[model samples]
Target: MTPLDKIRNFSIIAHIDHGKSTLADRLIQRTGGLSEREMSAQVLDNMDIEKERGITIKAQTVRLEWKGHVLNLMDTPGHVDFAYEVSRSLAACEGALLVVDAAQGVEAQTLANVYQSIEHDHEIIPVINKIDLPSAEPEKVKTEIEEIIGLDASNAVLSSAKSGIGIDEVLDAIVERIPAPKGDPDAPLKAMLVDSWYDPYLGVVILVRVIDGTIRKGQQVKFMATGTTHLIDRVGAFTPKLENLPDLGPGEIGFITAQIKEVAQARVGDTLTDAKKPAAEPLPGFKEVQPVVFCGLFPVDAADFEKLRESISKLRLNDASFSFEMETSAALGFGFRCGFLGLLHLEIIQERLMREYDLDLITTAPSVVYQIELTHGGGHIDLHNPADMPEPNKIETISEPWIQAVIYVPDEYLGSILKLCQDRRGIQQNLTYVGGRAQATYELPLNEVVFDFYDRLKSLSKGYASFDYEQIGYREGDLVKMGILVNEEPVDALSMIVHRSTAETRGRGMVERLKELIPRHMFKIPIQAAIGGKVIARETISALRKDVTAKCYGGDATRKRKLLDKQKKGKAKMREYGSVSIPQEAFIAALRMGDDA
Candidate 1:
C-alpha cells in the first residue's frame, strides 16, 4: 500500500469563544472544504445550543485539502466540562491548532487543553485570532502566551477568522508544524476509532484513522467489544469530497458502515482490525470518563419511568459521557439519577436525552460530591449522588467539594468583583494585571458556584467578565444545614447544606424564594426555615383552587387530578404530621437564592 502522499491529521483546540469554530470556518473555506458561496460560520458546531451558546460541545471532523495534501481537520469541544471528549480527539491526532484570543490572552481552559494536548504529545501550532476586534492586542497576548506556556508566541501568526486576514499563514503553519501519520502500510490492521455519528436510518457511522494496515469491503472484522464480527459494508474517504475506495491504507481517515447491531460495539476508543490480526493491544493510554455532576432525572409522568430508563440506556450507548442507574423516588416515582461532568455537560446530556430520545424529564438540582460517614464504620468517603447519602447522624466529619477559580475582568471592576466573590465564601488567592486587565483567582467551594454564578458575575461586570475553574481538593469548612419548611414544618426534600456564615441571610432568602416557586396547595403552603431542628423564619405560598368548587365547568368536574398537578406546580402541601410536599420548582429556587443574597 502506497502512502496516500496526501494526508495530514490535526485538530483545533482552544477555550470557548476563542475563535476555534470561527477559525475552522475560515480554514475550510480557504482550503476547499467549502467554497465562499457555501460558507456559514461555525458549520462544524451544528447543535442548537452550540449555536446559541457560541461554543462547541461535540468534536467535529471535516476534510480539507491544501498543497496537494488532504488534511483530516477536526474541531473539538473547548469548555472544561467536555475535557474527556477533547482528550479522545487529541489522542486520535498527531497535531493541534491552539487558538487564543487576541484581547484576552491565555485563559485557564486554554492552559488545561494545551496540557491535555501535550500529554498526547501533539505538535502545537499557536494562532492568535480576533485580531479584527477594536480591543485586539495580539502583541500583548503573544507575550502572555510566551510567559505562561513557554511557547514561542512571538512567531505566532495573527489572524482574523472573521475578516480572513493572514488566514493562509495559519494553514501553512499547520503543514510545517504538525507531523504526518507514519506506519508500515503492509502491516496487519490497526486503526483507531476517533469519532462516531448515528443516523436513525443508517445505524452507526464509524470514523477511523488508519494508523496501519488496510480495511476493505466485504472483509470479516471483529469489533474489540462483544467479539461480534461484521462485514465491512463499505469503505470511503474524503478529499473534502466523499470518494468511494475499495480500501484505505496507512495515514488516512475514512467512514465505515458495518452491520453494527448495537452502539456498544462502536465505542470511540475501540480499535478495528482484521480478525486474525489485532493490534499489539488496543493502543495504550485511554481512560473511561467519570461524571462529576450528579442529579436525579424523573419523568413528569410516573408511567414514563421505564421509558426514561430505556431512553437513558439507548442514549448512553451512543454517548460515553453520560452515566446513570435505575432509581426510585417516593415523590418522583421510578426514575434515574444521572451524572455528568458539570453544568454544561449536564445541559447537553439532558437536552439531547429529551430532544433525541424524546422523553419528558424532570431534573433535580445538580450537586457535587459530598463526603459522608457510615454509621457502621470509622471510615469516611465520597458521595456523588444524593440517593447514596447516609441517614442523617452517621458519626463524623463531612465536607463538600471545592474548586480553585480564576476570574478575569477589566481593571475598573476589580473592587466590585472582589467584594462579590468574597460574599460567596471565596478565599482570594492572588490578583494580577495582565495586558492591563485584572485577574482574581480564588479557592471556593464547588457548591457555591453551581447556581447562577455566571449570571451574577455577568450582571456585576456588565457582561464583560469570564471565569473558569477545576476541582481542587476539599477541606472541612464551617458548615450549616439549610432547612425549608412548609406550614412551619421542615421538609426533608427541601433541606440543603450551606456555609455557616451564610445561614441566616442566605438560608432565609433561599426558603423565601422557595415559597414563591412552590405552588399553592389544597391547603396553604408556608415556606419556612430551621437550624438544628428549630424553626427560625417563615414565608407563605398562596392556597390553590383559585375559582373554588362553584366555578367548575359542566363536563370538567371530573378533571381534579389535572387541576391538582397544575395547582401543585405553584404550591406545596402541608401534611398532618411534620411532613410537607415541596414542589419541584422549590428544589431549584433554594439553590439560586445564594446569587442575590
Candidate 2:
C-alpha cells in the first residue's frame, strides 16, 4: 500500500458539458490506467444511457499511480439533478478539481458545485478546460472564477482534456497541492461507504474510503448504519477496471465485495468497521436525499405489474435516492408511485426501467409534494398525489414547495429570460451583470418550475443560459387540485394541483391537447377540467356521423324528419351508455403537454 503522504484523493467538479468527464479520461490515459485497447471515450461513464445522453448519472471512482504516488480520483455528475451524487462524492474526498470551461466561464452549476466543495472544506484547484477551442478565453475564466468563487485562480492550470494538453500539470498539482488524508494506521478498521451498486456476477459491489486502519479480504466488516455484518470476500480498486488487492490501507479508496444478497445491507454514507474490533464511534453519515418530484409508474400490461415491482426493487438497489410505494389508480390500475429528485431523474429512471427491464409502462403526469394543513387542530399531511387530496372543506391551506433559482445568461437574452421567469410567477431576488453576462436570482414556486420552466428558460435564452436551484421550504399558496373528467368520469392519473390563477389556462391547454390526442368515438366525448364541482376548461370530440338519409334520397320531408328524429334518439342513448376508451398513447401525449407547450 502507498504511504499516507503519497496518497491523494480528489473529485472532479464542474457544470454540465464543461469537460469533467473528458478531463477524467485524459488523466486516466496519461496515468496508463488502461491500455489503448481498453480505452474508450468517457471511460468512467459505464452505462449506455449515460454515454448516449452525454451525461454522468452516477459518481465513478478510479485509482491510479502517478510518479510513485497513488491518486484516487472521482468523476461526478455535473447536472443539478445529480447534485446529491456530487455532494456524496465530495464527502469521500479531501480535494476537488474545479473544472471551468474557458469559453463559457463560470456557470450557475459551477458556482453551486464550488460552494459544495467549500462546504466540505475541500482544497480546490481551478482548471481552465477546453483551451484548444478557438473561442477559449482562459484568462477571462480565471478572473471569473476568482471574482465569483473567491478562489485563487492566478496559478490555475490551463488545459484541453480533449487534446491531451497539460495533463501532467494537473496530476502534479493534485499531488503537490492537495493535502494527504490523515488517519491512524493501527486503529480499528474504519471506512466510509462512498457508494454501492448491484452487480449480477457479484451481488453488491461497495465503494469505500478507508479513513483509518485497513480493510482486507476475509475480514468481517459491519455496516454501522444497518448494523449488519459481512465477511469481505474481495477487496479491490478500480484501474478503470477492477484490480484485486490484498487489502486497502489508510487513506485509500477501494471496493469490497461480499456475498451480500440484499442491496439495503450496504447503505451509502454508512460507516464500515471491523466486526471483531470495531471503532469506538461511527463516522458521520451523509445527509439523506429527499425526492422532489413524484409520479405514478404503471405497467401497460396488467400482468407485468409484478415484473415492474421486481424491476423497481432492483433499480432501488442501484439508486438509493429514488423512492416508490404501491398505489392503485382508477384509470391506470395498479402501479407504483415513485419519487425522484427532479424531472430528469424521473425520466432517467423511467427510461432505465423500460430499457433494462423491458417493461411497457404508463407514467402519470409528474407532481410535486405539497404540504396540506388541516382545519381546526387537525394535523398536517404531505400530499404526493393530487387524487389523494382530502376534501377542500377539511383543508385549511395548501402549501407548495418553492425554490431559489440562480441563472446565468448572456446579456442579449437577459430581458427575455427575466420575462419568462415573471410569466411563471417568479419574484426577482437580485440581478447583477458580470462582463457580457447577467446573473439573476429568483424565488419561484417549485410546482411551476417542475412543469416546463426549465425548457422555456432554455428556449428563451437560446440554450445559452445555465440554471441551478435549491428548494427553500414551503409557502402557503392559493393552490387547488384540478381533476380531469372524460365523459363525466374522473381520471385520477390526469389530476394535478395548480395555482388558482393559472388553473384555467393550464386546464384549457390539457383539455385541448387531450381532444387532439384521444381518438374520435361513435358518440361525442366531452372532456372537462374542473376544480371541485366547478369546470375550468372544456373540450368536445365530435362524433363520427353516418348519414341515415343517404338511402332515402327522394323521400318525403316528413319521412326524412321521422328518420332523423329516430337517429337522434338512438345517438342520445349511445352517448349515455358508451364509454370513451382513451388509448395509452393519448395519456402519454396529453401528460407531456407541459413539456411540448
Candidate 3:
C-alpha cells in the first residue's frame, strides 16, 4: 500500500488557453511518467475535440512520482460551462495549482475557480504561466492575483510550460508545499467518484479518490447517494494510461469497473464505501447538478430517432451534468428536450452528437424555466418550453431566472462593457478596480445573457474581458411568450419568451429574418410574429410566378387577355388549396434570430 503521507492529491485550475495541459505534460515528463518519445502536446487531453479547440472538456487525472512522493494531478476544464466538472475535480484533491496567464493576469473565470478551490478548503499554490511570451508580465500578474484574489503572491511560481522553464520549481513546490492527503487508513472504506465514463468493453468505469480506508478488486462496494451496491471487477490507477493496481488505499486516486450496466447508477460526487462495512454517513459536498439552459434536439430524419437515443445514452455516460427526456413537437416532429449547464455545454453536446454519432439534428431555440402564477387561483408552474406555456389570460405573473454576473475588463474598455451590460437589462450591483483593471458585478436575467451576452461582451472589449455568472434564483419580470407563424400557422419550434419591452422589436426581427430565410413558394407566404392573439410584426414573401404571357407572345391582344385572366384564376385557387413547406434551414434561422442585429 502507498503511504498516505507520501501521497499528494492536487488539481490544476485556470482560464481557457492558460496552458494547464501543457504544464501537466511538463510535470509528467519531468517525473519520468512517460518517455520523451511518448510525449505529445496535451497528453492528458485525450479527446480530439479538446485538442482541436485547445480547451479541456473533462477533468483528467495522472499519477507521477517525484522525489519519492506520489503526486496525483487532475487537469480541469477552464470554461464556465464546465465549472461543475472542475468543482467535482477539486472535491477529490487536497490542494490546487491556480495557474494564471502572465500577460492576461487574472480573468473572470480565474477568480471564479479560485473561489471554488477556497470553498473546498484546498491548499492553493499560485502559479504564473507563459512567462516565455514577449507580452508576459509575471510581476504584474502576481500583483493582480494578490490584489484580486486576496492570496499572497510572494511564493507564487513563475513558469513557461512551453519553454521547460521553472518546471523543476513547480514539481518541487508540489512535493514541498502541497499537503499530503489526510485520512484514516483503518477506517471504513470511503471513496468519492469524481468522474465516470462508459466503456463498451468494461461497462461503467469510474475514477475515484479514496478518502479513507482501502478498496480492492472483487470487493463489494455501495454508492452512498443511491444505496446501490456492486462488486468491483477491476481496480487500477491512471499512469496517464490505466495501469492495473492491486488495491487503492487512502489518498490514492484510481479507477474501478464494477460491471455495472446503468450509467445513472454511478454518479459523480457519489461516495463509494464497503457494502459490508458501509460508512455511517456519506461524504459532505455531494449534490446533484441542475441543468440551467434547455433546448429540443430533433433528428433531421425521423428514421434516426432510435440512433439519437442511443447516442444520447452514450454521451450521458460521460457527461452526467446534462439531462434529457423524450419530447415531441408539433412542427419539428419527435425529439428529446435536453438540459445543459450553459450555452457552451449545449453546443458541445450537439457537436459531439453529430461528430461522434454522425446524426443530423435540428435544435430548437433554447429557453430557461419560468415560474408562472395562475390568475384564477394563485397556483404556479415551472414552464420550460414556451410552447407549453398556459394562455396569457390564465397567468397572473411571470418570474424568470436571474444571475449574478461578474465581469473583468481593462479600465479603458469599462464604459463599453458597462454599456453592453446595461443594454442586457443588467442592474449594476458593485464595481471595483483591481490592479488597473475593472471588476464589475451585475444582476441580470439569465435568459438575457445565456444567448449572446458573452459574444457581445468579447466584441466590445476586444477580447480582453472575461465573464462568469451564478444563478440568483427567479425574479418577477414582464415576460411575454412570442410566437412565429408561417403562412399564418403557428410554428411551435420558433416560439420564445421575451421581456415585454423588447417583445415587439424582437417579434419584428423574427419575422423579418424569416422573410429572408424562407424560400418563396408558388403562392404568397405571409410571415407574422404574435404575442397572444395580437400580431406585432408581419412580412410577406411574394409568389414566384412564371410568366404565362411569355408563351403567348404571338397571340392577339384579346387572346392574351383571356389567357392572363385564366392564369390569374388558377393562381388564386392554388393559393387557397396549397400549404407552404418551410425548409429546415428556415426554422433554424428563425430560432436564432435573436442573435442578429
Q: Using lDDT as the measure, which candidate wins? A: 2
Tens-place lDDT digits, model 2, residues 259-336: 987666777788999999999998874666789999999999999999999999999988878899999987788999
lDDT of each: 0.75, 0.90, 0.89
* Minimal lDDT window, size 10, model 3: 588-597
Decoy 1 TM-score against native = 0.82
Residue pairs with backbone atoms closer than 3 Å in model 3 (clashes): none
C-alpha RMSD values across all candidates: 7.6, 1.9, 2.4
Residue 445 of model 2, lDDT score:
93
Candidate 1: which stretches are off by over 4 Å?
1-6, 35-38, 218-231, 238-244, 261-265, 271-274, 299-314, 326-335, 352-361, 378-384, 419-430, 472-483, 488-492, 499-505, 517-526, 530-591
Ranking of all predicted structures according to TM-score, beginning with the best and ending with the worst = 2, 3, 1
Q: C-alpha displacement of 277 in model 3, angstroms?
A: 1.6
- Candidate 1 has an lDDT of 0.75
Per-residue error for 597 in candidate 2, Å, reads 5.2
TM-score of each: 0.82, 0.95, 0.94
